[model samples]
Target: MGRARCWRHRSPRRWKQFHEGCVPCQAVGVASHDGYKRGDDTVMVDGGVGDSDESGLRSIDLATLSGVLRVCDVELLLLDGNGPRAAFASRVHEEALFCSISCGFHCRGRFMLPPDWAMLGYLHATDETLSWCHGVPLTPGMALTVMPEGISEFTLSPGTHMTLMLVPVARVQRKLTELSLRSTPPAGQALSLFNLASETTPLAQHYQQLHVQLGQGASLQPEETEKLLHEHVQALLGAGAADRPGCSRARRTHYLIAQRAENFMRLNLRRNIYMNEICDAAGVSERGLRYAFEDLFGTSPNRYLSMLRLCAACRSLSMADSSRRSVKAIALSCGLWDLSRFADNYRKVFGELPRDTLMRAPAQIGQPA
Candidate 1:
């Protein structure tokens, strides 16, 4: 068995960002001595820069398959060779968005998205190849996005290096409102409620166009680009989250803990919350509090607090007379210090801009009959 060379990222900042954004982002510095084994399966491996001299990256060997359905941000930078392949699948447990740019790589993979989302995909490749499905063929350089009833499939070949990003839209909107002080505008203001697949509005189309144009240009700065893309992602998540109603189901233990945490946050979202403070209030150790929050909400204490503030902001947006009070003031009251981020998150989660949410009169909460 010949040893494969390892690949590790040399830049520290980039490495840090990659790890923070995609936990378990490991760089195999180089692939092991064994070259591509004919049979091996690993769903994910640590991320690294281009391959180094001494080691080759690990392959997703077909022998052992491990997958976990959880909310995450994943970025894969691969230098592919001949006869390489990776296959992924999920049902009801994931809402995944993938973007593949094949400078000179190829393979095939498929994906399934949660309902209420029209599948949106962007695939860029060197050779003119196509993915034909649902009675349509997506040509190279031409992006293929589908909103299948429930799921979709994908394929890649050797020399196919791509980036795939996935987000459960249904959960996105809820987290958006939870994270920022903004309300989703009424139906009239929203261009359209999310259906699986159809022509998008002019405004939505424009965003995609601009993004593509910028991606092709060399003048666009990576930092600025990442910031903008991150905002777009946040907005997408928000739109995804808004499809569901709030605080519906509740359990005894989970309810009490969530309610207590939420109430405590409501009282102090305007102020920065410390993890220890939350633990002290919940009568649990810091680790215990952190674990509970992640288990119940799929987020950390700080993240949950931010979401609470956003939730309060959403409630207030519909209740308070926004004509007189500005959204900035509302956000400040909700514990968010950054107006720009608040607005961005507001727009992302609610499917409409913040001003739109405030333009109309406040709404009254429905009373139980």
Candidate 2:
């Protein structure tokens, strides 16, 4: 894969400020690589720079049958399937996890959001679907109702393409207050997932169009994004969570455990810790630990831990003095044992190597001469 060009960021403060303001940032850039085959039918694009934080275009490459992409900062994951199964996820700060996906999968969890974000989306099938929302079959178009929370399992059939936009609750509430209207923004479970594609409503049609644009890796303008959020909130306010207030107590317990575990992970990022330690810290059993992680992260504890540590290492590299410490030393401090693998993963995610980032750090902020 070819190396990506990076802007010289002067300091960690600049990085923080840039990311903090980039709520609707673009995902763009392309790097080709040797294909790695998995099992019998899956192949991964070996090494590639997915996008730069300051890049103007959203991803140049589309995830489809012809090409496979595995980018890190956007947290792209393509699971093994008959063909290359792929999904793209990028968070707009702490407000949301923006997702564009084309895959057939099954998930068992309820979103454990921080009470400030609301999940919204538009989805349709390229072929027939075996998809279900809550307990009912989710068809192409219909009037919607609030779905009960803590669904046991949600399934999607092959050839399902969708766009999920997570809007902060504060944004929705503010929008409603501005219009002199008010409605409860049920945390995505109690609103209309099925009728998002209904042809009868202009709003639904607009959602489909926006979803298609997002699938093509187009960035919505700030105004347009706000409009979409407002539309979703207005629709949701019509149907509050109370309509489907039959969430399982067991699932709620899982969410509580997951939140506690996440808090523990954040506080102890500097220290290398294990799953058992986290379980003890959260006061949850092994099974509850598994359930908590799967519900919140959609992955295992080990994978999530690695991600946290890697991010911590990146922070150090972005702010530390190269004269005082080598990349290997900083990595070891963050519990990363392999230098070669760390550089590769770091470049794939951030579009630059550790040394490259350190070189860009301003002299005034890093170390005492």
Candidate 3:
């Protein structure tokens, strides 16, 4: 991995003014609007720079892929012990936000979309049968959805490349009204997955090209952005009308069971949690729980739970105050009590000991001596 560097253009007043008038910036809580130019064929940004020369994409390597976007609440757990090494980049347009992500390892997570905004995802590449959303397999030509005010679960295989666009619900609805199309369904409806090959293939291809151009440091004019947004909304609604497949009953059951168990583990990470407790919380027998986990996550319950604890410990250590916090405390808090074993496992998963991560944390400001 190349060294990580962050550059800040400290014009707070200018940024504030820009944020006030830019809906996308406000929606995604962008701190600054500084632009990046292609340097040495790598996409460099104001805050972080991507080091990969092959892709020439500006991406930030994140420890935990949470809070990467202010509009979405994303909690991802790496299924494999390998470091997440998530490559993330985004551009906030006047009426939409576009993002591209490529993960280096298998992972699963639940994401809650911002209220009043709809997220459209296109899988640029993925391993066969390894990418899924809410128990439905994802393919290259399918349109992914997490409707406004909706929460969904997803899993990504190693080396998965995805493109995402987030547009406000009101804007899409207005476009539908103008085009004499149906408005969006009421909130809380299950998200729809539809193939985009027939009528909407050109739109999908166009969107992918636009994303590539933007990632390569091309700028979009105001009218051009507006037209792109209109076309995207139209494509989304058209896909909805085409043949779509709903999540099967068996898959939905397994997903819910796994989701409940995972939620229980996350909420009670402060102490040791047993399999029986997890099964009870999920309202399933031990055998049923194991089947559900294996079906959804391709792992046993015990292993997945262990991975969760380790990831939680990593996040805590990465964000903890080094002056006041210790690896032992964070490990115990995440239910890893054996200090020696915890250190070994943490190193194996994160490529560093707990103390090393803590040492790298930014020091707290305004401390009293």
Q: Judged by TM-score, which candidate is best?
A: 3
Per-model CA lDDT versus the true structure: 0.38, 0.47, 0.64
Task: Tell me the tens digit of each residue's lDDT in model 1 across 1-369.
Answer: 011122221243432333234323121322323212111211123222233223232233111111112222111211122211232221111223222223222322223333433333333322323222221233333332233233232324333322233343443344435556343322322222221122263323433443343223212233332333344434344454333222223323433464456457657777887777776677778776666555444456776566556655755564466545788888888887888998887655444455665563223223110
- What would the TM-scores of all predictions be? 0.30, 0.48, 0.79
Q: How far is 8's C-alpha from truth in model 1 (Å)?
A: 57
TM-score, cand. 1:
0.30
Backbone clash total, candidate 3: 0
Model 1: lowest-lDDT 10 consecutive positions: 61-70
Candidate 2 residue pairs that clash: 27-58, 27-59, 28-58, 146-190
- After superposition, candidate 1 runs with Cα above 4 Å error: 1-257, 362-369
**Local accuracy of candidate 3 as per-residue lDDT tens digits, 233-332:** 5665665544465667887898889878987998998888999999999999999999888877888999998888887787777677877888889989
Q: RMSD to native for every prediction?
A: 23.3, 12.6, 7.6
Which residue runs does candidate 3 get wrong by more than 4 Å? 1-64, 185-190, 198-200, 221-224, 240-242, 363-369
Better of 1 and 2 by lDDT: 2
On lDDT, the leading prediction is 3
